[model samples]
Target: MMAATKRIALGAVVTALIAGLAGCSGLGTGGAGSAPGAGKESAPGAEGNSPAAAPKGAVNLIGDGSTAFTGAQPELPRAKRLKPGQKPPQFVVFSWDGAGEDSQKLFSHFRAVAKKYDAKMTYFLSGVYLLPEEKKELYNPPQHAAGRSDIGFNDTEGIRQTLAELRAAWLDGNEIGTHFNGHFCGPDGGVGTWSVEEWKSEISQAKAFVKSWKTNTPALKGEGPLPFDYDKELIGARTPCLEGQKNMVAAARTMGFRYDSSGVGNQVWPTKKDGIWDLPLQLVPVPGRAFETLSMDYNFMFNQSGTTQGDPDKHEYWGNQMRDGLLQAFDRAYSGNRAPLIIGNHFESWNGGTYMRAIEETIKTVCTKRDVQCVSFRQLADWLDAQDPATLARLGTLKVGQKPKPGWTAFLAGTAPGKAAVGPVPARPADQPAGKGPDGSGD
Candidate 1:
């Protein structure tokens, strides 16, 4: 069994190393930036229903030539308003935190999976991953010393690999969002204590790293720029360990952000938080266990193995438990309220890589189902924006696992009782904090 003391020490080291970084001027990427379909008109032949053909347009290089405008991204589904009485399509957002390509090759591997399964996902790239360790001093975190990152920095080859994956992922209709830089969590100058301004600084640095990778990793300066303008592509993010959301949201609202997934919430239709769509991680069953936990791999591992590495013999069982639990959650939403199932994951191979297996299985099982749209958070947000406000309000009334009692036609035909002239649904009260595990260590 993994020792608790060792876990604690590791957590401390990670937290201490991940102090926030400083921002720099120039064309920077946006934090969890908005994806396409946020009210932008689609180009001809870019129907938004299917992935477009190879980007057809002159590649207009942006600042530092690290990213470019290659035209509307391919493979984005068109956001259409629901027909009268139409049952809303079930949306499942499979998003990765701190997305990067490393020796594990999970990023590229999943890109293939998404293509095979006809799904698109969101990749929240950590800024420091692109900033080589040699140029680490370029990062000046909010409260921590310069040149320090909990997750450390990447090498030129690592940056090149990550950039390639990012380029391909975006071309495949995936979103390139920011997980920010340094990943500072907990108290004591962690992200939780950051002011709105501090959050802004961190966000700026996150974008700067992406926009300036060509300058930082000079060895790979010949790399083609990332296809989309990150400032326009990023419109959302989940905070580090889900901390400091209050200030982060306040800062994000003004920084072109459209949504945030940094909170713990129920498996219900999402509502706006301070004008930003609050797409949070949901609570899902724990299989045989009576209680539910956040729909994340780390939470399940925390509840089962209690560490990144657990009993080898039980790895298969643990994997199945997580798979079954996620499927249960999917079934609940699929057959009932049809709330968009928001699932989060990391690329780490913790617990013998069982969670990765479970996630892949879950994707294979769910993405191919009829009427199920496995999409990125940006796509979900776009679909949400295309709906009639009253219809969405009516849909929100159904509780978790509670289907429309009167059938879809009647339930959403008109406004429900007591909800006159459906406007933006007021933000629901916060649910259990989902970012941290039982012991407060989570991805």
Candidate 2:
């Protein structure tokens, strides 16, 4: 049963969210339903939102006030400029797509895990999760019928749980980016077919859902608002199926997004595409395989299980394979170019939850290591923005597995690598496409 209809100062469900949804969702998850600690001073409504989350009082609402303008976010550490000759820290970003707290409660679970590790991650929220299933028709995604969504819709409880998790996630200093909506992947009018205007529409609807969930979810009128102003909080995203990246980047750049994680790249310093940071999923070593796969669980599962669950007996082996692959990638960077490592995941318990265990174990193994900083995409972007452009350009010259020829101080002293030393761009594949992402995350 849905929770009791709770009324607050927000008044009747506003009609703002009914406007054509222009949004998306990406990444994936399988979570438990427990309410995990948000790792902050517990709010008045610690079980979920805060008393001031909604408009019970006079709140300065931005735009149509679907979202309120809160003050500067807490706990964000100002980025520091890397000193000359100082080696860059190893950055590992653990991100989630389609982030929500369902019965699995993976959203909160991982938030807690990140807190335990002194890490902060990015959560790419699907706008639909904030829009109740009954109101699905309002979504009208491009290339799909009204109410049509590849990932289905959320129930009242699901929405409540997701809202709670999102509230906690943000307060804990994690990023809340978008995964868009509808999750239309594949050749049949997938994201690839979307025009720049269509992507803009998608992006708009994505923001609308978060901005005005109170209007769509009558039962949540008094649940309080999401912790931060999503408009200011959101600055990045990952595209579904990793398709339509070219077009998405074009659209996202104009929308003021700072970065995108929808492409496949080698583990190297990042660059810009369409003016937004192109933080692509990277190719990491896959144990027992000659070729590496994206640093995402879906890719590992796809390669190991052939898109099937695979042999139940081999689940452990598969899990270890993923763990080993990520570790190898981590070590290569920690000991090599010192470029940030980007790892993506979903919350679903695919392949008997082996991947989750692999990720959990990997987090324990490396997140606490010296000089390893498990950060969010936003924080990484901030740090990158604080660096010397010439330093980044120089660091970009180091290929994956290729250390600075002499050392970090000399190699990145604003000097270009030798033709042979630079090698091919590390972590980027030349022929990557838009839809090659793992089952639920990036290509």
Q: lDDT per prediction?
A: 0.75, 0.72
Taking all chains together, the TM-score of candidate 2 against the true structure is: 0.82
Which stretches of candidate 1 lie above 4 Å from their native place?
Answer: 1-57, 415-443
Best by lDDT: 1
Model 2 residue 333 distance off true place after TM-score fit, in angstroms: 0.7
Predict model 2's lDDT versus the native: 0.72
TM-score against truth, every candidate? 0.83, 0.82
Shift in Å, residue 410, candidate 1: 1.5
What lDDT tens digits, residue by residue, belong to model 2 across residues 231-250?
66778998876778888888
Give candidate 2 regions above 4 Å deviation. 1-66, 413-443
lDDT of 1 by residue, 116-139 (tens): 888889998899989988999999
